[model samples]
Target: MSLPPQANSTRKALVLFSGGQDSTACLAWALERYAQVETIGFDYGQRHRIELDCRQTVRRELAAQFPAWGAKLGDDHVLDLALLGQISDTALTESRAIEMQANGLPNTFVPGRNLLFLSFAATLAYRRGASVLVGGMCETDYSGYPDCRDNTLKALQVALSLGLDQSMTIETPLMFITKAQTWALTEQLGGAALNELVIEHTHTCYLGERQQRHAWGYGCGSCPACELRAQGYEGFLAQQRAGA
Candidate 1:
């Protein structure tokens, strides 16, 4: 998909970056479209704290590799959402095995996660005078997370605009794209080098195992998150091979 033209070089954006593949791709997407881009991550006491480390690593690497683009990013913010983890007992927060919930949601599903995240991110964007907020939530190839749906994000966008009494466009470049498409997007935004940097630095394992690497990236290779990433990367490789 073609990226929309930037309204102005002064226009800034705040990206909801989790340092996972999708969010990392969104960060790259934001950098390409916005004159100034800032990223925010949540420290909601997740069991996989390695993702947070990945976030910082990715940020530093981007700053080093793409100095011009990285200069556009303001101070990165990592919010404390420890209370959310305290109240929620799920696979992502606790030691429980991942399974489908009784209500049909996955055990990894943290209810209202995106809602709260975007809400907070909107506030941050407003304060920073940013007209755009970007996130990597996707319905396609998702693990049945309701918050990842485009409709939900659109509704939340309207609600946030109304609440803030300001015009804020929530950009979800990865909303409709599959994970394989996300990898392609990384290349589109930067190049093969940036894509390789992401694969080498970003962490997506629910189990947070970094020692063992896979075809996709670092992960336990057995967790649901790793499986999804591996599948998408495999699909991406297949597509590349077929095109070749």
Candidate 2:
């Protein structure tokens, strides 16, 4: 969807940043449009907890490389949602094989993950005076996580607004866009420099493997997240070449 009016700089935004590719792009998108932007992450004891570290690098690089966005960037909050990990037995939170479940969903699917994430993000936003909540929960290129669906987030938006008695807007800029489009969006938001920054800094491996780096970024190259990123990067290059 088109971004909220660029003129609305008076509004503050809170992004649900997981230090992953999509969330990193969402952060850039928020930085480009919002006057003030803050980021929130959940430390739910996932196997790839390295993403938590990568987020800090992404933030620092963004501030150092883009002064304008850096000025707009605000506080970073990391919530200890260890309860989520305790409750979830998925491949992400546990040491298990990444495979499909009999129910048709992947083992990586964490139940109520996005739901809990948005709820907590909204709570934080309410306290931070940020009316706009931005997330990278995309339906276009995802692992069929029900919580990532647009309708799920839309419903939660209404519930959050009603529960808080405030008009809260959940903005998913990447909801309808493909992963390749997400790469293009990063370039559009902050140019080639931002694209490179995201590529080098963001972490998408479910296994938390950073020892090996690829043309797309760092990952095990076998997990679903890594494969999606690799294919998307190739598609992004193809788009650039075709345009050239």
Candidate 3:
């Protein structure tokens, strides 16, 4: 879906950013819509801690390269949730081999991760007097994470609003878009330069390797995350070549 026009400039928004392609795009999306946009990242003790570095790098580059939107970037907050790592044995938090569960969920699936993230983001937004919480959870071209579904986010939005006794809107701009579409979105938001920055700075690989560059992003190229990103990027390039 195309982004709606900017509403009240005084309105504030908090984005659940992971410094990944989707979240970075969501960050730019939020900046376009809200006058005040702040990003929050989770240090959930994931094995791929390099993502945090990528987050910082992207934030800095955005502020430097795109001053108008970048200046809207408020304080960047990183919450320490190391306990999540201790409690979960998933490949994201653990060094174990990534595999699919009987239910077809990859080992990277961390139960309640998004739930907790949005809940926390709501609390933060409430404190900041923000009415909207932005995230990058997408069911399309996703890794089969149940929490990424639109229905799940809608339910969480209700629960958060009821529990907080405050009206809250959870914005999932990427909910129905594939990765290739996500790339298109970045270009639509800020043009080709923004898209290029996302491709170069965002980290989507499950293995968290920065040196090995591909058309998609940096990754070990062996993990499921890498494979998905690569495929989507290839599709995007093919579409571009076909003048679609």
Candidate 4:
């Protein structure tokens, strides 16, 4: 679907952009749904920055590709959560050795980071007059962050509405979708404008390797991000073959 014009615009969305495939696709999805789409990013010292850069590429691409629409990447609304380190000992917050288990949440969990980010995003959305805040948070495909679950999202919705005294929607476009669906959505939105360019540009890896795969256009294809990405790509391929 095409993005509706501002004249008929009643809904606005603030996307939590990390510039990964999912978030970027979610941004595109928001574009199709909301008349105005704004993005907010966080530089919480998450240990990897490729994702942020990936977000930048998407913004730049939007500016270049959708110049008529004037959809530049929204402000780099990142809050430095460096202070969280003082109280956070999570693997993502500390130099602690995080071992990946076969099943269950990993050590990469950053305590209350998503909650805090959403709270900040909610406040920003209220100030911006947005009706919704879109995020790339996923449940079907995720890194085991508890906050990414469906229940957490629903609860956050309630908390934000109550705490802010305003109704703002937290939209997770990829919550039920696998990684492959995300890529396909990007492709569907702008074809080469997203799928090929995004795969090559975004930093979806947790390991944050920039030069590991120049051909693929992303990061270390061995990390958790890579695994999920690989699965998504594989699913995308399967869909292509099935023609469904």
Q: Which candidate achieves the best lDDT against the true structure? A: 2
The C-alpha stretches of model 4 lying farther than 4 A from their native spots are 1-8, 72-74, 95-98, 101-103, 214-216
lDDT of 3: 0.88
Residue-level lDDT of model 4, residues 143-241, one tens digit each, is: 788889989989999989998988878878778877777777778777866677676667776767777774345666766777778877888888888
Show model 3 residue runs off by greater than 4 Å.
1-3
Decoy 4 TM-score against native: 0.88
Error of 1 at 180 (Å): 1.0
Q: In model 3, how large is the Cα lDDT of residue 183?
A: 80
Model 4: ten consecutive residues of lowest lDDT: 1-10
**lDDT tens digits, residue span 92-117, model 2:** 99999999999989999999988988
Query: Which lDDT tens digits does candidate 3 get at residues 47-92?
Result: 7889999999999988888899877999988999888888887999
- Residue 120 CA displacement from its true place in model 2, Å: 0.8
Kindly report which residue pairs in candidate 3 clash with one another: none
lDDT for each candidate structure: 0.87, 0.93, 0.88, 0.74
After superposition, candidate 1 runs with Cα above 4 Å error: 1-4
Winner of 1 and 3 under lDDT:
3
Q: How badly does each model clash, as a count of residue pairs?
A: 0, 0, 0, 3
